[model samples]
Target: MSKKKDNLPNPFNEQPLGGLLKSIDGFFQNAFQNFQFVGGFPVYEYETETHYIIEAELPGVKKEQINLDIYSNQIKISVESSEVIEEKDDKHHVYKSSNSFQRAERYIILPFTISQKDVKASYRNGLLKIMIPNKKKRIEIE
Candidate 1:
């Protein structure tokens, strides 16, 4: 009797597996439902001796929807999206309507010493790339 009891697994009492699954579900729920997390707004940063680069994943976003503010010690990135894309056939009958706005004011703040005069930004293929040169150097890298 004792051996049989030991062999049986606790379906509702075992916590390791259940707890892990619950946490995973909560993570996604919070990230999506609140809109504030948004998977941390996935970003990558690189610093060279001459410049600093920041690349952020922003799919389905237009170039006009993005804004940036650069200060001597901090950089702020804001993305506001209010786009309504529609497609029509030759008959002028609209069948499809698309709205590409999953987030608004997705602000990213970071600290760096950068020059404002030579700041460059571009968006291509769902990615936003911004380059800021170090304040101490005016040399541009090609």
Candidate 2:
């Protein structure tokens, strides 16, 4: 009886649903691991004893259009930008395009507590840099 129980057939192993589920799972795994879908937002982060440095790329965005919300250990940044493109083909056809996009957001999570009020950010040359101060205070002992 024990031998018969151990040899019982596995239903999923003989079904097409198992392969379909595996194919779906693999497609998503490859997409996430390739990092192509979210390739527009490139970030570089490093940690120090007193501060966390984060640099990101936001091309053609102005400082006034950017927003930042800081939490104990998370950083959220968003921006909106627009552009107007106009072209004339010789003397015949004229094309004009006005495109607007909102909510280019990048959220970062860290292990250390950061000061919300003291966070500093600077933007120049299509690059944005931020420095987050550690909440843990250092006491100087003489």
Candidate 3:
């Protein structure tokens, strides 16, 4: 009798449907957040004891297409492109067309004091690197 009771399966062993549904819902929420599209450039900020580096992944964009504006305590990057249409042929024959685009603005706030004069920006291999040196005090811009 004791051996048969030990071999019997527990009737309470079952999957909790509520807990499983919650887990499935959480997975979909995370997947949707990561799959969203962002039109602007992707940027990352890195900091050191002496300086801060702001790098933007700007592929297929020309060096001249980006503009950096340094305000009182913020740096804004704006890119603009436009498409132009050129018609080389007439009516029913043939036509050559081209499109242009304009870049939009991206803003970043600085955690440390940075002067416009001490900032350096460069573009290499489709990446835009901006180096901002640390300053103890704010410098007046003339």
Candidate 4:
């Protein structure tokens, strides 16, 4: 009686798709590294007979962190934030700290020119409201 022993690599233990998956994951991670999740807030624009109104919803933003600029026919809004985190361990005599800063800006163009003096802005409840007087003059039919 003779016994034949065959040695073959097990296919189940080999991960053929592992490298592909890792490459795909790395590609996506690198692609999205510069993508901003909070690029800008939601803005609503409307006009009445006398004025134009703009409302922006900025959650978790402080009023002092917002800057508004009015041009002849455009409005620019800028928001900036800074955060600091520190951790200390008395027993290990270790201290760690980190700081991060973020800034976002948006621009809105108007159909007509606007006076900077007539523009008014207010922030309340994380909402920024801007009012600009309309410069268009209505003509009467003769």
RMSD of each: 12.3, 13.5, 15.7, 8.6
lDDT of 4 by residue, 1-142 (tens): 8988778875544565665576457655644233242467788999899889999988667899899988889999988876665779999797756555677888999999887888999999988999988778889999
Across 7-122, the per-residue lDDT of candidate 2 in tens digits comes to 87766656577766775676556433422224357879987897778998877667887778888788887775544435457675654343433356788997776776788999
- The lDDT per prediction is 0.65, 0.70, 0.72, 0.79
Off by over 4 Å in 3: 1-38, 91-100, 136-142
Candidate 1 matches the true fold with a TM-score of 0.48
Please estimate how well model 3 matches the true structure, expressed as its whole-model Cα lDDT: 0.72
| Alpha-carbon shift of residue 104 in model 3 (angstroms) | 1.9
Evaluated against the true structure, the overall lDDT of model 1 is 0.65
Pitting candidate 2 against candidate 3, the one with the higher lDDT is 3
How does residue 127 of candidate 1 score in lDDT? 90
Highest lDDT against the true fold, candidate: 4
For candidate 1, lDDT tens digit of each residue in 1-142?
3545466786654676776677567655643442332444677888789767888887766777677787766667776644465667878663655454454444444455556677888899979898877545457899
**Candidate 2 global TM-score:** 0.53
The clash count for each model shown is: 0, 0, 11, 0
Best by TM-score: 4
Better by TM-score, candidate 4 or 3: 4
Q: Write the per-residue lDDT of candidate 3 for residues 50-103, one digit (tens) a residue.
A: 778899887767887789999877899887666555666666566645454444
